[model samples]
Target: MASLSQLIAKPATFSVSTPRTSSGQYRPRRATVQCASSRGGERSEPDAPKHQDRRDPRRARRQCHRHPDVRASRRRRPRRDARRLLLRRRGPSAERQRATCCPPPSSAPAVDFTPPDAASLPLRTRPAAHSVTADYVAKFNAGIAAMKALPPDDPRSFSAQASVHCAYCDGSYSPEGFPGVELQVHNSWLFFPFHRCYLYFFERILGSLVGDPSFAMPFWNWDAPDGMRLPAMYADQSSQLYDPRRDGRHGTPKLIDLDYSGTEPRFTDKQQVDHNLRVMYRQMVSLSPTPSLFFGSAYRAGDDPNQGPGPLENVPHGPVHVWCGDPKQPAREDMGNFYSAGNDPLFYAHHANIDRMWSVWKGIDARRHTDLTDPDWLDASFLFYDETPQLVRIRVRDVLDTGSLRYQYQDVPLPWTAARPTVTRRADSLLAPAAQAAAAAARKAGDFPITLDEATSVTVKRPVAGKRSKAEKASEEEVLVIDGIEVDRDVAAKFDVFVNAEDHGAVGSGGRELAGSFVNVPHRHGHGRGRGRGHGKNGGGIKTKLRLALNEQLEDLKAEDDESVVVTLVPRQGKGKVKIGGVKIELMH
Candidate 1:
């Protein structure tokens, strides 16, 4: 890492292409972004491949995944004509070019960004999707219909807005200073703020189009029992809100399973609902008690993207995406994959709830569960064209408050607060008497950075006693760091983390040892863009980290007084493809 002084001294310049029309053709004028570089060291560009595969139209189609009308456009063109059209447009050397989802640059000159004063904005209330009246639904449908009616060239159009998510998520653009390093918002601390800003502008555009400045989008409140099923408004085929690309099996009357991972559970509807409430309790309370545990690991300039996702992002967030997507489509076309998630009308409503979680998190503990104060996190910025079609730059600091943005969620019942998980048995009984006697010593002596060919476990030392006050120990969280994870991006991988649990320790009713899970729903990536610590063929994998807090879990396991606890890594999805670098416990005071 470079020093703060050295990072501040370097000027960072990013090349921005001209705005593009509906046909994905660039305009004449170009825009450039200039800012103080925060990267510590210079990173060389990735090495080019020796061969290029340009003959296949399937390869080319994957590159254009960001366009919302891609599937429709493909259906319109004949098979032979589509191939010829692609070849004619791309030329022979097109294989060498990198696929990108970068949105059109601003037509105007770039300027330093500053957030508007909070007092200047009027308050607006966002309603729950299930509770909205017919009038509100009609207005929202009209707003979406209006956006879709606009030409794709317009920045405020539905197609352009959807592409914004793809550009930021799918390695389309690089940070201002880091040339080859991709700027991704998903697996880092940038996830919450980035999405907040995106939805803010999107809501504003919809409001302007409908001639209702106070128009607020509805949030799919899937967290509660009554709001568990897909919102009724979105399921109506006659409405513009309906999308045919969703999973047909997950339609209305089917309760959403928060812990869904491709495989369906045989639990009854009541059981599923109860399970979802417990899932919410574990994710929002037990698993995530700190900002770092909730928002995820930090990703600085020049760092590889997908560092790791927070507890909530790894579970219900990821699972909900996979559940809604059509299972038949390759890469689960609409809501499942990152590239095309925004194409579905349900995507915005789904994210509106995610954005709502940010507020609910703060209300849980106003003082302790506040926003991050890191300078790198606060200064990170993005470019977006507002409702007026004027390009404006916004930073993380600009969106720290819902009041400042002039929006508040409709108050609802939080039944999950009382659903905290319980441990039925003792941890020592999970292992044999002899194994328990030597567990700590054997764990301490064992080597780390092991490959996950099978279920792996390690013993991690707890915080030293007498080093801190009792009050500090009670307030501060104990975080488990599973650093330097390497895995293939093409593989559907998932693994659950458990504390002090052996194979025999698993509870039959409710998973007592289960802490949380890390899941990666497979998505297609362009050739030659894969670069990381993994040794996959064609350099196709990612290197990241995962963190989980143990403040409440330790107490449940009756391991708070113990000096060490056995940490287990159970591979539920991709077994041999995962590799873990090391594990340790740190007291975050």
Candidate 2:
């Protein structure tokens, strides 16, 4: 046997090129995920009660899952591969695999998931119902033309008359028209939903501009080595869209993998959906404080940082190709970078993944989807225009009904009772409650780090949270500026919190800091038809007593009827301990 490096240099080319599998064959490709993989550092599952048996059933699932790929290769590699060819002939997706990359033998592209290549999947020639066609650039130009035609301040200004609001508002504005900036949701957690909505509209605009009703948003998966180049728009360096860069490596517009080591490979934008869906498959049932705490960052917690998902909570699971951007003058953007809502085209695809994760999570555990009916929690209402272009008042309830309006995502695998969620043997039961309080609390911490279920992996440069004074208000934009505005940037990276700066980090209080940790509660998934909230027992039914330390004061938070009690973080300037929210007042203020 030659050395490892030598083997790679002279790797043998297959004699038959793996015998062309026909179209419609389910070719399992290597998992390609986008945005952080949904299994995103496990958070505590919604408090699954402990089993006295001291034996974890999840161990059984992992033992069972042992994907057909690993096992087949071990048991009978050649025969199993040959069988795949036969299955392809019988499958419905034989023709579509030409372009898709590196499908795993087991995680094959399913007949259902594959779309007919552009040739077979012709553009509906019958005049598009609306203006946008498949070409986003065309639609963009048209929108510019249309916008120019409209008179100034014609509700169309702001590109579509959008009203940005504090997403963390728990419905305080239901009675008062607008909450005037109800800001308890911590500025740190605000950006995720805001940009999510922003991207939603951008996609609509892109679609409208191109005249293709079926166009979807793309993503910026920078983890892969090939993704380092600048998107086409930025590549030219001639446009105002350029961003400064360093030498040939760091700023070369290439997607940088947080895990520089060569383990789990990164993916392409097109491939990451299913990869993420799988991770989301687990997350749908599992709960973690990561999404709420880190927003779009990576999440983890462990004895060895590298032993788990590492610090990059928003770990890039896919390739670097920009679905859209200034490619020529490449400069990659963080998932939670200085991304303002209105700009950025691929923003929609990024959020599409977020939305999909939401759907997956809801399906896995219905209870996980419901907001804690805590008076403060329910009082939040985020403002967003409906597809009809009317600013409809929405709350956590509104977000729950993703299918209620005009959109639905592409048909992806929806984990049914058959494909039960696995309780990873590697999970720490201790993190469940902490994870629960995390979800309940940081439902809005934009980029703050939470105890990632995988291990305590944190995203860097988190946003901050803090209150604003009445005098500091009046001049700012909305209710967040009313109650308290988020500082909007990583507190660790950019510590400036003054109100007058042109680029104020939106996450207030120097980024949201949650006071919860994960702990085991009850096993809910795969139990029965599942409750309206989850697959097992009701979330409201669980007696979740969370031990939270608001500043220095410690208190145990219990789950109310579909309500989450807000352990509001009150950060005062200068280091001083003070009592404001929650009981047991002696907290680390």
Candidate 3:
């Protein structure tokens, strides 16, 4: 395999349609995102075939599978106003899309024929410049040096005090912006790259402060049913860290409060919508809770603070694994307008995982990875920060050439590499007695650990769940393909859409649904309080689950490959405004 230097130095190809930098090279295709307030034009198209399918099969099977009687289920506990993110769940009619996996009478291959594993492929290795550990340290120093160069009132300085400004409002940030774009660099495509960039800087600062350059990022995925507690880095009592139940009054992370064991997920109009900002208002803004005396104004749910219901209360763990994002983080609102690569702190690592998840998705249901050829969805563009920290724009086409990029993550074995999905094995005794008792209750209700693929057959000894409004059961199998990527049919199995703005990791809806919503409410008027109840600052707290789907339909990705199978996925949604940096997920529940 070519070295990392070759990947970074690979020349970017472009046409008038695909934007290129002043250097006139497609180096890292990033665009200077212009908000609704800026001059806008549809992006230039590329010369490659609209759709390209290059999924790695080894990873797909991990998405999920059933042994024989496995069931698909979701419980609609009580609906709290906040959890009403991105509207409601809509899918094809239960006829084909529901959780049942019994195949209809057909002669289709029981499983698609597998091409022999591509003959031995070369391994990807990096030289000193492309090294993850090395770059991490260098970038850390660069950020610190840059931070020191900024004035006291500069935004970077404000970050030191956890005083992020409202990217929209000229004032301090709110996790969500108020009226204008947050930082020029913030936007939808930028979410991952930006945060990864932020984390690079943040990690360096932390490393510099503590004398530990090797401190890896503490991912919060430890909350699975089996690994359901904060990782030891944050939750160890001996560490003497800040407890959520104790010092939890901040609209910020504590000095070292990486623990996210808030017990249950946050629900309620104010709590749910606070950070998961939407794009309905003049601009999206972060509504994360604060140490202040009161939660602010809202038409719904927000009590008079002086009156009933109190100031936006939190119903913790009402449901777990939920979160919204900071509008300042990109990838939240739209993929077409920004660069997502360089913005995220965990960009490389996170995508490594997401890419891994895609492999897992197709592995679970080989057919689910086919792209439904659709048009509008195919021509999307996103932004990213390059290895040089220069914001460059990219398209779905650009991502296909992963080897040409500067970063490639360390190899981590997939969860489903085993014959049968071990899923996640935990010592049953690891739970606190209370949690253990709770697990028993959940088990009785068939809500214990679940491997989500609908193909998997397992017994759910309990009565299955539902609030199925006939229409609620999606039957029409409309397929959506965006750029060249196919949303695995089982996207929903791995993710749960939520309301906060700063919460990243969940899938953002693609365009079709938003277009539908636009067709429904042609005017840009308010639609009540949206999912956030009356307290949401704008749009509604909206974020997609890690499930394999987009928010819309695309009929544009059919290449001349008879070996490829066409699959459908639901894309994430986007209203008319800019919701930048919604991609930066500070914390996810």
Cα error, residue 211 of model 3, in Å, equals 17
Clashing pairs in 1: 449-581
For candidate 3, the TM-score is 0.28
Report the lDDT tens digits of candidate 2 across residue range 1-589.
1111100000000111221111110112111001000121211122222221112335423211111000000011121222211110111122312211111111111111122244432232111112224454344445545533544223233323211211111110100111111111112222233344444544444445445555554432232223333344333344322333312342433333221212233555433433333333222222132233123211110000011111112222112112222223222222122212123323333345545544444454464343333222222233333222333333333343444423544444343223222222122321366544444433232433221122112111111233323333212211101111111111111111111111112222111122321111011111111111121122111111122212111111111111122223323211121111112211111
Q: Which candidate, 1 or 2, would have the higher lDDT against the true structure?
A: 1
**Candidate 2: 10-residue stretch with minimal lDDT:** 4-13
Badly placed stretches (over 4 Å) of model 2 are 1-253, 256-341, 364-379, 385-390, 411-589
| TM-score of decoy 2 | 0.33
**What TM-score do all the candidates reach, one by one?**
0.80, 0.33, 0.28
Stretch of 10 with least lDDT, candidate 3: 517-526
CA lDDT, every prediction? Answer: 0.66, 0.24, 0.21
Candidate with the greatest lDDT versus the true structure: 1
Candidate 3 per-residue C-alpha lDDT over 1-589 given as tens digits, one digit per residue, 9 for 90 to 100:
1111100000111111221111011111211111111112222122322222212223212211110000001112232232111112112232312111111111111121111122322222211112335445454444444544545333233122121111110100110101111111121222222233333333334434434444343332211221223223223233322123222232222111111122223434332232122211101001111111011111111111111110111111101111211223221211111121112222222223333332223344344332212221122232222222233333333333224332333443332222111112122321346533433332221232322222111111211122223232222222111111111111111111221111112313221112111000001111111221212244232221111111111111111111211221212222122111111111111
Would you list the rank order by TM-score, best first? 1, 2, 3
Each model's backbone clash number: 1, 148, 135
